[model samples]
Target chain A: MNARGRIPGIRNQHQVLFYALSTCIWCKRTREFLEANNIAFDFVYVDLLSGTEREAVVEQVRRWNPSVSFPTLVIDGCRAIIGYRPEEIQEALGL
Target chain B: MSEIPREKVEALYQRLYEEAEASGYHLNPDKEFTLGLVESLLINEARYGYWACPCRLATGEKQKDLDIICPCDYRDADLLEWGACYCGLYVSEEVLRGERPLQSIPERRPPEGQRPQEQPARAPAVSVTELPLPVWRCRVCGYLCAREQPPAVCPICKAKRDRFERFL
Candidate 1:
């Protein structure tokens, strides 16, 4: 709940922002899981961004979760989940 | 990324296998997946002069990416705790024997802002001083220290003791 800025993909009071790394296996799995479940979400490949942009995004992620690990999921702009925990993501999404 | 020939990748896999064996380590039990990771590593090495971990992003600056080289600093601890490294390329004995399941490992590398500043290069010197303690080198960050034993964990790179190599 320490996150800043408005969450993306908001619909029906539900919003999801996925932060990932392009080559990360867990990130890919999380993406596939969200898509398969028909969940609307926005994602940014932290590794694919330009140096400055990547730093800024990483800083934002750190603010939300100090770990700043990949596949970080932000739901409703307040609830943040670190790593690809399917059960947690599912619960957070109310799926 | 340029395509690496299958034969070349296989050759690199063979070498990596032998090296792992020699180092008293084991590759992941999944052969196909391990081979795929090896191929990716080869591709990264081709793109970047050094063999960087395929799972992690590399800055293409050797000094900046020292901790992400093939045998990354966290490999030992990851294998010890999670039965596999983050990428699952290296595994613990239990995982290798199928006695344990590979699990996701937390990132041990500190964030960029928290990472220790790179040490400046040493100036040329001719004097040699003998020490009673053994010298150990951290393969990931290239940190070298002479002590009775290597640190339980690398101070700079956070690599475990197994990651250290005898310098002398």
Candidate 2:
């Protein structure tokens, strides 16, 4: 999905994006697999955001995952699938 | 093969700053070093290719232990060790082989006034089924046994095969 629409009910409006460290092979593989499966997603480079820009994303991750890890998939709204497990991602997004 | 581009650096810096703000913490410059290291690893991989994952340490000794004779630091008993990655994910042959039970390492540092010891806790009644067959782990450095137990010599550190232990 394009990065234009907002998640209904969320105060700050921004489309869900895949938050990832750009150079990780697992991250790349996850992205490629998602794309290959025709799963629409926008990538947010965690390495490219400013201090204030990533505030919400980080909070959401902490609230879900036990740790701050790369290749975290934030979908629809607050739901997150941390790390790159193809099976988990498939099940999460219903791919 | 080339220096990190200004754009990449700026983007990385901005992202780290955002993460710090989001996480309610400051970013450490050492993170830049870690990023650089990973970047270089990626570049090298792209240029050359995938290499078999090399064992870092054999038994309890460094790889260089092969060059000199030794009392054979390798273990002949059952023991378990745990280590974690910067991302707080556990890294161990045990986990890779699916021998480890599900557990999460805490991300936050312990509160002030209490310093936890460095030892990692072991799982209860560790299933021997989960341990990999000791084909190549060094007795000296605890490196994974890639092939036959204790190769004629640890190709990584040159420790003789006699130094390896059977964890399986």
Candidate 3:
């Protein structure tokens, strides 16, 4: 019910946070790729947030991606891979 | 899945395809993928008051968002450099012909602060200076018109008049 969405997966090796726009097709692909690979992750639809909540989330994303592009994947609080980069996702999560 | 209807998505897809073709531009040949982006564009148009690019997060204010409209200000450059636009909706002729693969591209539009300010109004091009009317260029599709004001809608890409900038 909250802005953050969680999907269950058998693999939990890395803490994955995905910042995305609900209207972004690449964001949809990124979610589907995770689901297909059974990679657990938390996602936020940045476009759906309003007011201060939106501002805070935007700042969080900007820290990881200066462009604030959709489908930005932050892994284990260490590295961020921007765009729907499936290979990077696979390598980062070891999926 | 989004609540937007399949028929509505298909209709816009058709319209865009026709418009792109007429303008010597091409759309992605992947129907399902293109339709998904089209659906998002519709979602944005309904939510925001204009057809915002599906991939970019819109601030929901039409004035601040004028550059990122569906056929965004960067579409032509992105299409030339990457073969596909930022959203993969518009593709280059090579991509359409399968000579090149369409893939995810880095965002070309810089962050808000880093964006280059619009250039100062320039003197009219010397060759066209004698012409009576001023020229306006559509930032989206590069359509040019000689008139007192930019067209209310771009005849080629259908972008709003605000997307136009003085050319000469």
Candidate 4:
């Protein structure tokens, strides 16, 4: 829905809203990969946040894939790639 | 009583003691380590023998040795199905009299706010103000577990499901 008579790209510009635990090795690795690639992304620390905040996150994850897992990678507005594998992520995002 | 030297057990006990101390736990290193060795030996014994004793000891309602409970029980129950008690004289009496094999340590705490199981999300309707407040959508699949009601176990993949980047 746009003046251009075409669907607009998602307004959300960030590559990911990475959810992770501080002690979890994989979550840390995912964050490192995003930083190294210079991809600006949102990060949610599930351990530190309150119950309500956590609930919000769960709702979001469910929307993307019924089978969503952690270290979810959100692309554009509607696509999600779960877990962290740089090459797999790149391929999925066509980066 | 077997061929395993007492020195080996002592060394292991010493290392375990150091770890406990470093972790800020006040424990009698020799005693705790010996108990640990005994527990391991008992596990081996269970595999080979037909005898199995209760995993924990309790007096009336109080319990002890929360650590040895299976992780499954920790995550599945509402009340901690296990924890340690500190009734000093009673504990000493029991131990000295050989009535209690495992001594009570302090209760092992879970990470803050971590319940055994994720509470079932309530279907309470969000207010209009809350409406369109923000819903995090996953990028992997179009799963929506819900916000303002964080799903403990993601209904989809059972991830510690949480918010995603919001669209609006």
Q: Best candidate, DockQ-wise?
A: 3
Candidate lDDT scores, in order, read: 0.72, 0.43, 0.87, 0.40
Chain B TM-scores per candidate, in order, are: 0.72, 0.24, 0.90, 0.28
Q: What is the lDDT, from 0 to 100, of the residue B16 in candidate 4? A: 40
Best by lDDT: 3
- Tell how far residue B150 is off in model 1, in angstroms: 15
Winner by TM-score:
3
The per-candidate count of clashes, in order, stands at 0, 21, 0, 24
Model 4: CA > 4 A from native: A1-14, B1-168
Q: Over the stretch A1-95, how does candidate 4's per-residue lDDT look in tens digits? A: 01011112232244555654332334445667666666666666543444676667667766874433445667766577665567766665555
- What DockQ do you compute for every candidate structure? 0.21, 0.03, 0.74, 0.01
Model 4, position B32, has a per-residue lDDT of 46
Q: Over the stretch A18-37, how does candidate 3's per-residue lDDT look in tens digits? A: 89888888888998999999
Q: Write the per-residue lDDT of candidate 4 for residues B83-152, one digit (tens) a residue.
A: 1122111122233345544332322334323422223433434444546444544322234644664455
- iRMS of every model, one decimal? 6.2, 11.1, 1.8, 19.6
State the lDDT at B65 in candidate 1: 73
Candidate 1: which docking quality band? incorrect
What is the two-chain DockQ of model 2?
A: 0.03
Steric clash pairs (candidate 1): none
